[model samples]
Structure formats: C-alpha cells, structure tokens
Target: MAEAIVDLVAQGLLDEGTRLPTERALAQQIGVSRGTVVAAYADLADRGLVVRRQGSGTSVAAGRRTPVGRHLRNDGFTRQVSGPAVAIDLSLAAPVYDDVVARLQANTADVMAAGAAPHGYTPLGLPALRHAIAGRLSAQGVPTTAAQVLVTPGAQGALQLITAAYLRAGDRVIVDTPTYPGALELFSRAGAQVDGIPRDHAGPRPGHFERALADGEAALAMFVPTCHNPTGTTMSERRRHELLAAIRDHEVLMVEDLTMADLSFSGEAPPHMVALAPDRIIAIGSFSKVLWGGLRVGWIRADPATILRLGRLRTAQDMGSGLLDQAAVLAALPQLDEIIVGRRRLAQEREAVLRAALTEQLPEWEIGRCDGGYGLWIKLPQANAAQVVNAALQHGVAIAGGGVGSLDDQHLDHVRVCFTLAPEILVEAASRLRAAWQQVCADDGTTTILAAV
Candidate 1:
C-alpha cells in the first residue's frame, strides 16, 4: 500500500498537500485489512514522507526546506503563496475564454451532432479534426498532411508521449534555461539528464546548441521559439535558421513546442522550426490558448511513421481523447482566423495595460516588452521573489516566482506576471503587488519608497 501511494506521488498524480485516502476506504478498495493500511500510513509518516494531523488524516509532507526568498519548493509543485480565496491569480497563464464560451454555446448543436461516432473511440483522434489541424498547419507554411498529425489530450500529453517514446534514463536533453515548469518536471521525472541553455530575446542561441551538442552527449533538444512562456519573446528568423543548422549538423532530434504559436500578436511568425527540419523536429501545438482552456485539444505533427508509433503508445494510456471535444474543435476551426484576430487584439491590449500598471506602480522594476504572448517577465529590485510572492498573497494577489520557470534556480530576482486577466483586475492586482513590494521593502529595512511613474 505504501509503495502504491509512493508511485502515485512520484507520477505527479498525487501532488503535495493532497490528502491520502482514508485507511478504511483504501483498505476496502484494495481488499486489505484496515490494520495493514494503518501500518503503511504509519511507515510513510515515520520515513518523513507524510504528515499525520491528529484528526485531519495523512498529507504529503513539505519535505525540503528552501531559502525564504526562493520559490522553488523541494517538492515539485508550486507553493501556494496566497491566502484563502485569492483575489487575483497571476501565477497561472490560463487564457481567458469569454469569447470562446460564447462561440461554443452557439455551436453546441452542430458539435453534438458531429460527435455521434458509431464506435465512440478514435485512437488517432477524429479524422475531421486531424484534417482540419493539418490544413491549419499547412496554411501556416508547415506543409502538413492528416496522416502526419496525431491528436492528444493536450500539449502536455503530446509532450509526455514524445518524451516517453524517445528519451531514456540518463540521456542528455537540452532545454531553454527559463523554460516551462511542466516540461522541466516531465523531463526530470522521465530520468533524463536535462541541461539548460541560456536564452535571450531571440530565444536559445545557436551557439549554445552547438556547444551542447559538441560534447556528443545530448540526444534531444526542445524549444519554444514562438511566444516563449515567462519571457514572451519570439525567435528572430536569423536565429531560427542558425538553430536549425545546428540541429541538422548535430543529427539530434528536436521537439518544438508551438502551444503559443497561434497566440502571436505580432506579424506572421517566421517559418516553424519543424518545417525547416521536418525529418528531425517533432512539433506540438494546442488550442488551449487560441480557444478555451476547457478545450483540451492538441496535436503532434511529425513524420507518418513517428505519428503511428506515438498513436500505438497512446493506446496503452487511454483509448483516445473525447469525441465531443474533437468535434467541438472541428466545428470551431473554420472560425479560427477570426477567433485569433479577436484574441490577439485583446491580448495586446491587456499586455499594454499590465505594462503601464507596472511602470506606474513599481518604477524600480526592470520590465521587458513582448511582441506577443500572454505574460511579462519582470526583474525585481530585490532578490527575494518568494518573499514578494508571499507578500502579494497576503494582499489578496498571487504571482509566480521566477524559480518556478527555471531549471537551476538561477532566476531568483525575476517573477512572471500574466496579463491575461481583465483590465480592471489587472489594475487591482498591480495595486496589490505594489503594496506587497512596499511591505517587503519595509521588512528588509530599505527606505525605498514607491513613486508613481
């Protein structure tokens, strides 16, 4: 029983603070004696793996202690820095979906009618959705076919499949330094020796990839060139060509995460890295940003053989994603161009609002502008991002510390603030953040005063 619990925790299915099932319920479910369950829980507790409250049951322990100013918890999960009923959650980059919800509501009948599949199972996803996605990709200059597309639950699932299919224990994988936390967690859990390459506004440099590959140890490289998370910078065309040259020269496999591809508010994106190196790059994209977050539809675009292999591997996990979700996405694809236009306009406006708010409220902070993407990366005047996060939470605002997005805990003076919220909320959140910063300054015995920019 203890082993089973440990496995779940390791798999991230059971996150920290998640309460273990009651001993009686677990014993009944697993057909074990109550005393046996009790013993297992006690053993876990004795090993400092969990904490047992007198009347509250067993919960995963906060095992590793970190410096008060660092946000990276010893446990992988982002620590909840907010008080109860957080007023504004800037920590997450979840897309706002008021427009998407209205569209879905209007198309519900058509979506339902199309989802009436005879078998109700599509291991490779519904044919129409695949064709639609391929068409979209082709229009974006990637030149794809339905046969090369494999739909998954979301971008995360697509990433999981790619990592499981290609990576092995101790294999070296190169990723951007301030990459997505979920990707870092997945790669680490897969036992890959993940390495980080520093990134600038142009994205990860070709020189870094060349140097990493010169060691002849890296088997895989991952990139989020377009609308990079946390940083919100897109790669320049020159950088893309250089990076593609390095990938081809090194004979290494590349994973291109295009989850934010459609969310670009800038002009047309440079050619997709996958299109430049189709034989070596596997592209993953999702509609969660362009559409609604509730729509868990995403796809992997690769060679036909790779798609087939990933599809087969997927069957062992689940039959497939839901038919209704696919149908809904299919129904919405024709309007994708229109949808993206509205979304980009709103995102750009929100980004401007967030930038202005921060400039006016926190003038001492260094803020970078993003041509596209949903968040801003801010360098704090102080190095205690975790303290700022906790302070903001006390003022009813929640923000993410930079360590959550970094692999080596090197971004201690940075924080990621998403601009996806409504303008009024952004205003309030900025005010709360300013209050928090002042409180932090006061606690640190700094005489720095907030000045309106």
Candidate 2:
C-alpha cells in the first residue's frame, strides 16, 4: 500500500498537500490489517512522501515548508476524492434550490441601482435589511430592534466577529459534545480551551451545564438550541429554561445559533434564547439555510454595546458586507415566509425519503433524533464511521464521519448524512451507504461500540 501510494504521488495522481485517510480507514478499504497499514504509513513518513502530525492526520508533504491554513479540516470532514467524481455529496448541509439564483437575479437591477447611490459601504449593514431582520426576530418572539442587529457576511462571519471581540487565548468555551464543526474549528483556532457538555434528546443536561461553568472561568457558551446540526435535536422549551437558568447562575454570556431555527419540521420552535434573556444571550442567524448558502447574509443580535464592539472588529476585518447582497436580501425579506414554506416542505419530504431508505437498507443502524435540520445523525453498530466514510467515497457517495462534529474526536460509531437532496438521489445515496457499511464489516471483524459520553 505504501509503494502504491508512492507510485501515485510520483505519477502526480496524489496531489501535494492532499490528506491521506487514517490507517484504519485505508485498511478497511483495502481489506488489510490495521497494523500493516500503520507500518505502511510509517514507511511513507520515513521516505518523506507523507508528513505526520500529532493532532492532524498524515498528509502528502510539500517539497518546502510553507504555512498552511490553521485547521484545514475544521469542518471535521475530509474531501479527499481520488477516484471517480463523487455521485452524491452529503458533507455540506445547505439549501440549494433551483430557483435561488433566479430569485436573487430578479432583484439585481434594483439592488445594483441602490448600490450605485452611495460609497456602497454599510459597515453595520444596510439599515433596511437590519430593520427587516429585527422585525423578523421580533415576530419570532425575540423583540429585537435594528439598533441591536449587525449584519455579517454570514453566520460564520458573525461567529468570527464575536470570537474576535470576546475570546482570548486560553479562555474556556462550553459547547455540546457533538456540535457544529465550524464553531469547534473557530474556537480551536483562537486557542480557547473548549469543554463540551454531554447532550441527550432534551439537549445538554442542566447539571452538566452547571458543573462545566461552576469554575466561572468560561468566557462563553454556545448552543444550537433549535434544529441542531448533526444531531437535529431541538432543545425542548423546558430544557431551554433549565440551561438558561444555569447560564444566569454562572453569569456566562451565551451565543445562540439560529441558522437552522427557521427549518423546523413542525413550523414551530421554542422562543429564541435572546427572548428569554436578551441581555445575556447573543443570537446568530442567517438566510443561508432558507434562501441559499451563496447569499452570504447573516446577522448578530445582541445588546447595542456588544454590537458596537463587534462592529469595530468587523470594520478591522472588512469595511462591511456587500450592499448588493444586503439589498438582495431586503428584496427577498418580504417573501421570506413564502420561501420558508417551500423550504420546510422540501426538507420534510426529503427527510422522510432518506429516513425510509436508511431504515429499509440498514435497519441495524440507529438513526438519531432529527426533528428539524439538514442532516441526520446515524449510529452504527461498530466504531468504524471513518472506515465507512472512506468506503462510501469509493461507492460514489460522500458522508461525514462522527468525529466531524465531536469535540474530543469521539463518536467514531456515528456518521452524519444530509437530507437536502432530491428523493431519488437520497435513495441512491442510502443504497451506496449500505454497500459501504457492508464493505467495512467484511473488511474487519472487530465491533467496538463507543457509547456517547
């Protein structure tokens, strides 16, 4: 296997800086022993074909030392497709409706005309869009105002601003055990010590929350109270109160990501965390899930002081979000309900189809709660999620391993599959996943199940 990899690199098939799969995943794919794969990787490293880092897995070494992005696989998922083009990619969970471009294009003329009128920079966001976002949040029970909202390039940009403003090196952050990989990445890059609280169906346990923050040194606590990313477990109203009480007791500032809140299957969710404690909780929202990821429009709702602090950081990063994009969002704001309705129906239907297919094809696997959200979390009977992910690529389906969303690189028996694709495509993806699971099973005899912490 090492010789084959060397040959591929020599032939320019394996590009430089490409990450290689873990020993177990490669071993499972080729039906080799883990020890043999380990030795193969060791040989590759010795021959300077691959570079091995302690935390980061092995990657093809560059000829000369060059700085790389601080956490390239921060999404917790790897996209190392070496063979044929992938048939289905479930790694990114975002809406990609056909009419999205048409909708945005319809507003281009007016938006451009408006953009041409000014210096075209609204550092805190266009006033109209901010008002619309505030109104939208108020209607959802947050009682927000334009003065408290700062438009960001996206929810991710909002996170970056918040982190830049508040977090410092060695500060502690509280998060769910298996949470958004993006948040994990940002926090890790900022050199914060992340402490993940174990979660159940109801959400993070109040007791654990109290304990994690008991030291009172935690700078922030972040939660996806509605339509959580991989797990899809929306915190119940009761769970919300319990956690909020703990936050109050600890006097800890909280960040609530409502990016997936609007996609609830029931068309109803608990009040925004900001609504319950407006002063303590900062809210991050985006149209990426409902409108389109390319929209690049999201907001941060917090106290005016906090918004101002973040705006200063934002201005340092970039002048502001694009005026045209904000105007386009303003054009779509009035039609948000109409768009959300279509998005909800699509998510519900596709989720059902994917669930049915997975149930029929891989009944032995356990599907986690998915009350709302783009992805479904699956628990396998064995701790081979990485192996299955690698094998799935060979079958032309790309899925994320459990470790993608985990704080401690745990949840090895889990995998997350997005359900935003068409019904037929989802069915085909599930079939491919089953085939991959079977391949991994046949390749290895061990069946270790790592119970969720």
* Each model's lDDT: 0.79, 0.81
State every prediction's TM-score relative to the real structure: 0.82, 0.81
lDDT score, residue 312, model 2? 83
lDDT of 2 by residue, 383-443 (tens): 7788998899889888888876776457878989998888999999988887888788778
Tell me the lDDT of model 2 at 191.
50
Q: Give the per-residue lDDT digits (tens) of candidate 1, residues 151-230.
A: 89889889988888987655788888788877876666555667788987788977887998998668788999898877
Report how far residue 258 has shifted in candidate 1, in Å.
0.9
- Model 1 poorest ten-residue lDDT run: 63-72
Clash pairs (backbone) in predicted model 1: none
